[model samples]
Target chain A: MKLTVLYFAWVRERIGLPRETIETDAATVADLVEELRGREPRYELAFADLSALRVAVDQELADFDAPVRDVTEIAFFPPMTGG
Target chain B: MAVRVQQEDFDFGAEADAFAEGRADAGAVVTFTGLVRDRPDGGLREMEIEHYPAMTERAIAAIEAEAVSRWNLVDSLILHRYGRLRPGARIMMVATAAPHRADAFAAAEFLMDYLKSRAPFWKKEVTDAGAEWVAAQAEDEAALGRW
Candidate 1:
């Protein structure tokens, strides 16, 4: 499946891009993270601490265990500091 | 009820009046505005707020719905701004209306609490020294436990 992955805040800064299109067979968000981590050192560093990050699948908040199959977009960022 | 995420600033007085207009049953209206504050040293030049456009509206809508249900609110409005803002600029505002003061106040606080930690907006402060992202506070997350 083709997925459009997005990064925000420091996650985007660390990864050096705001968004990317990935063709992968990973079935879950955790799996996709591992796949991306293997593709480059930047991914490894940015995702080094999953506890510091939050994710959304198809624009809705979801956990790392959330399945990625049949999903079109995934966004990764730090805990929000909004008001 | 309305939830709006925009890049432009809003008028607080006009919005407040409109929110309460024609709602004779509503005896109380509460509002909270968040502004960009400079550091104590006063070197802060600007604040750039970034948000997930696709999700911001939906997330705030869900929050508004919850507040309305919990407090039996007559109406509510949430306006959050993004992009560049100078110090003292308004960043966001939340207004709530209910039949009584307690429900209006509590619901407004609840909206602010959830909006602070749950909404997908992030703030980056740029100063004469450098640019830095605002870190999320542990206290903000813990505040959710009360609700």
Candidate 2:
């Protein structure tokens, strides 16, 4: 599946890229993250601690275990604190 | 119930007037406007807000719905602005009207609390020294847990 991944805040800084398009065979969000972590050192550093990061699949808040099939976009960022 | 996520600033008076117009049952109206502070603890200069297009609106709508369910509110309006915002600029507003002040105040506060902790918007501040990303406060998450 083809997915557009977005990184925000400190996650974007650690990853060095704000967004990207990737083609992966990963079944879930966690699996896709692992694939990215293996591709480069930056990905590993950015995703070092999943607890500090939040994920959204197709613009809805989601967990790492969520399925990624048919999802066109996935965003990763620190937890939100806006009013 | 009205929820508006816009890039333009809004007038509280006009919005409140519109919300309570022709509604005699709305005896009390509570409005809360959040503005950008000139200084943060970290010496921040400016705030840059970014939001998910579809998700932000949905989240706000859910928050408004929850507030409506919890209170006997006559009408509610939530307006939030996005993109770059300067110090003293209006960031958001939440207005709740009901037959009494207690319900209006409670509902307005509830909406603000939910928006603060639950909304899916990211903020980055540019200071004279450097740029830093804001983190979600544990207290905010705890506040949501109460409801």
Candidate 3:
């Protein structure tokens, strides 16, 4: 499946991009993170601390173990500092 | 219910009046606005707010629905601005209306608390020194426990 991954705030800073597109067969967010981590050093560093990061699949917040097999988009970012 | 995410500034007084006008059943209306404040680490130049365009409006709408589900609210509005904002600029606001003051007030607080941690927006403080992303507060997450 093709996926559009988004990064916000510091995650975007570390990853050096706001959004990206890739094809993956990873079944869950954690699996995808590990896959990306293996592809480059920046990915490895940005995703090194899972506890420091938050994930949203298809725009709704979800856990690392959450399934992403059928999702089109996923976002990774630090905890929100909104209003 | 109204959920808006934009880069433009808003008029608080006008927004409050617009929410309450001609609504006889809503006896109480409450609005909370958050401003950019130069504080503990004060070298303040401006703050840049970043948010996920695909998710911000939906996320706030879900929060609005949650507030309505938990309280007896007549109507609700959430307005949040992104991009660069100087000190004292309005960053966001939430307004709630209900038949009683308690419900209105509680619903407004609840919306604020949830939006603080749950919304997709992220703030970066740009000071005279440098620019840095603002971290989320532990207390803000803890505040959710009350509801």
Maximum-lDDT candidate = 1
Point out where model 1 deviates above 4 Å: none
Candidate 2 or 1, higher DockQ? 1
TM-score of each model, paired residue for residue:
0.98, 0.91, 0.98
Q: What is the C-alpha local distance difference test score of each model? A: 0.94, 0.87, 0.93
Mind giving the per-residue lDDT tens digits that candidate 1 earns over B1-147? 899999999998898888888989899989999999999999899999999999999999988888888997888999999999999999999999899999999999999999999999999999988899999999999999999
**DockQ for each numbered candidate:** 0.91, 0.74, 0.95
lDDT of 3 by residue, A1-83 (tens): 99999999999999999999989999999999999999989999999999999999999999999998889999999999999
Error of 2 at B142 (Å): 0.9
Query: How much does each candidate deviate from the true structure in C-alpha RMSD?
Result: 0.8, 2.0, 0.9
Compared with the true structure, the alpha-carbon lDDT of candidate 3 equals 0.93
Ranking by lDDT: 1, 3, 2
Candidate 3 residue lDDT tens string, B50-137: 9999999989999999999999999999999999999999999999999999999999999999999999999999987789999889
TM-score of 3: 0.98
- Tens-place lDDT digits, model 2, residues A8-77: 7788888898889999999999999999999989999999999998998998889999999999999998
User: Candidate 2 has which clashing residue pairs, if any?
Assistant: none
Could you arrange the candidates by DockQ from highest to lowest? 3, 1, 2
Tens digits of per-residue lDDT for model 2 on B15-48?
8788878989988989899988767364766888
Docking quality of model 2: it rates as medium
In candidate 3 chain B, what residue range of length 10 has the lowest lDDT sum? Answer: B36-45
